[model samples]
Target: MKPTSSLVWLRRDLRVFDHVALHQALQDSAVVHCVFVYDTTILDALPRRDRRVDFIHASIAEVAAELAELGGHLIVRHGDPATEIPALAAELGVGAVYCNHDYEPQALERDATVARTLRDAGRRFLSFKDQVIFEKSEVLSQTGGVFSVFTPYKNAWLKKLDADPSVLAPYHIEPHAARLAPPPSPAPALPTLAELGFEPSNLAELNIPTGMSGAARLFEDFLPRIAQYKDARDFPALKGPSYLSLHFRFGTLSVRHLVRTVRDVMARGAGGEGAPVWLAELIWREFYAMILFHNPHVVGGAFKPAYDAIQWETGPEADELFAAWCEGRTGYPLVDAAMAQLNQTGYMHNRLRMVTACFLIKDLGIDWRRGEAYFALHLNDFDLASNNGGWQWASSSGCDAQPYFRIFNPITQSQKFDASGKFIRRYLPQLKDLSDKEIHAPWLVPRMLPLDYPGPIVMHDEARKLTLERYEMVKKPGPSADQ
Candidate 1:
């Protein structure tokens, strides 16, 4: 009898343990070969000193080392995945290729091409759900259609998990000893960042380590704070957010394991408000993923077409406003501080994300897509789905988005969230001496001020009036049809 040879192609899900596709390949086949392709399609479009690329490179190195210790080596390739996967499969004479499902628009298209190439070569192509607990149409409304809203989808998701909780079981990898074949002659060298026309980035300086080990460390550190997550997550002054989002984005952390842990705590009534709230955040993650899957158009366009009717600031004025927003000179301390946090650390708190996003689209009358793209360039944990969803949500253009007239008052926000101005002072050191009451709106303070600090970039009242006028141009005095 011949051994069933299969190739395990790794993408975002980079870990060896508790990986559904990897574990399945090891169990169902005799020899399981692992491979990671540095997709040229994505890399070529990125800037030379992209931190995401550096993060991926470091993560793959960790993965390769782990697999090498188990008597197998990861075959690294650089090119169009559609070409590389089939070429490697032929070289290894593998009967099938297995991988986890990816929901991004580009990934789906790339996978389709790879699937076609593999099928032409008479090889089996298999993909499994390993990332999200519920995907595609898994958790639907009673009428049997995809859910556009989150609450009902979440209720359905919880109900499904309660009925069949075994789906969250850990998939321990058991690689066969004799399965790893001898290396092919003249193995290709793993391409260096320089070779790929990418320069060195300050990924280490950001203190965001890559790989499963790093993910484990972060998750462990976050567990003690899980109980207080609901209260602490909103305040930027505190170290509250799990900070594991980057790990989750890159597939270093397993979604199934997270869901299980969170659910288990909730079941025991131990997590309190934190459990349900954090779980809601996770559901938001899943919801955004599902939204991306269902409406791939949201990647570049508005989720609701009516939003496209809303004209944005253009010409020189738009550029000026965008520049102000990006440079942390938007006059709003919380907004400025949030932008600075994103620019300096590549991470922004959830509350700040909402506040700044609203400030950009509503206060500045800028397009939500502009802010979305800026975030895409800077965020370390930037997922296209979540970023798009968040930007659209802030702009009142996405499904179940905030009401158009319910604009966020930046001054009020800073006062409520960062009462002592500690968060603002951390990022805007020049404003360190401001009183707690005056910190939210520093222009109102007296002459006792920092010499270096600039005055308010744009008057909040005028900006708010301009925003409402801009919105009125698109909408009349009537209820929105989508609502």
Candidate 2:
């Protein structure tokens, strides 16, 4: 039986198209009201000048406008969702509340609390998977076990999709658009940044697109370059990436739309190697989500329990080095430049993420969690699962992680990826006078150093040796060692 009224709670899935919860609610109810909460429980922990909050506010405003155009209006609120969602449902006399699934632990707990409260009030709470193509154990191994390794999980994901392409199909919502209800009273105007207790950020100046329209603009631009993604993605200076990660993180764009588009291009034999590589990158995201779902302990500790025994640097000197790394003053051009980019702009190139992570963990011997927390605070595209996975991978404490002995040489990484040092110069203008070769490691240039540019903080060779010795504590026993 159709519910008399339903409320759709917008969380990460911000778009109206291909939206599982919204579609389901519309189909099952005579009238459906859509609402977004600023979610004070989460927001209270954030800074007063966060670009992410600005991005979300802008995106939600766009969504509100779009809904108005569809003969529906969005109800915006600012409070704890656990209390606010139930109160709104009661006020609207909603028989059910619908929303997309949120995989993070805190979200799960929040949902449980809300669900319990709704149940007590005789209203059903429903959630649908809208974020990833595959989630939780949906693409498990043949033995019914969750795959720890990404390659196998991705293979299984592909096979499942091959067996059932319907998974990529969009959830059409327009046909049931008439069911979308206007606000109970006069629609409240979307709140201003000041009202939400935040200041205007550089989000507008950066022009990092927000909302569904912005996502569409980015995807339209990326379509022609999808074929070149593999070649360009690793180089920090190149326009290789889709730059759609922030959209994906916020759910302004549907994962189904992206995967379907890529699949169609690959089927036409037009995307070349880049298509599959790009698809694999998306799969890696789901893989990390699954890892986090199955092993929540990874949030605070190593995936491999043995690695937790390895000691990390924690004294005043280590704190000083960490502060330098955070502030982008570590003096290694590539690492410093990457940190600078992350500090100045919330985005960091993927290759730089790896190099900077390695520099933090392997070079400075700081705890990976500290770096993870830093990224969590600063990255506009931060998802707890992916952020934790990347840090664990860098620290060699994650499943399918880089070997502890395979520490990155940050200078060479910069020289190889940013061969012309264009990216470095863009973020570290002090190195502009240095040639490409010298810019990568300016200390070796033998010229009198610029007063602003600091020398290399730690010699890579010494750091590499120290890292090896440090990781030795967690090394497995060989036959000779046993003898």
Best model number under TM-score? 2
The residue ranges of model 1 lying beyond 4 angstroms of the native Cα positions read: 1-3, 175-178, 181-190, 448-451, 476-483
lDDT of every predicted structure (CA atoms): 0.85, 0.91
Winner by lDDT: 2
lDDT of 1 at 473: 75
Q: Candidate 1's residue-wise lDDT over 1-483, tens digit each? A: 223999999998988778998887877888889999888987888888988888888888887877777777788888889899999999989988999999999899889999999989999899999988888889888899888888988899889888999989988774353465445566555678898789878888878878888998888888778889989999999988888888888898898898888888888888878878888888898899999999988987889887798888898978988998998887788999999998887889999999999888988888899999999999988899889999989998898788787778888889888999999999999888888888887777876556666677677678777766777777664332211
lDDT of 1: 0.85
For residue 219, model 1's alpha carbon misses the true position, in angstroms, by 0.8
Clashing pairs in 1: none
Alpha-carbon shift of residue 158 in model 2 (angstroms): 0.3
Please estimate how well model 2 matches the true structure, expressed as its whole-model Cα lDDT: 0.91
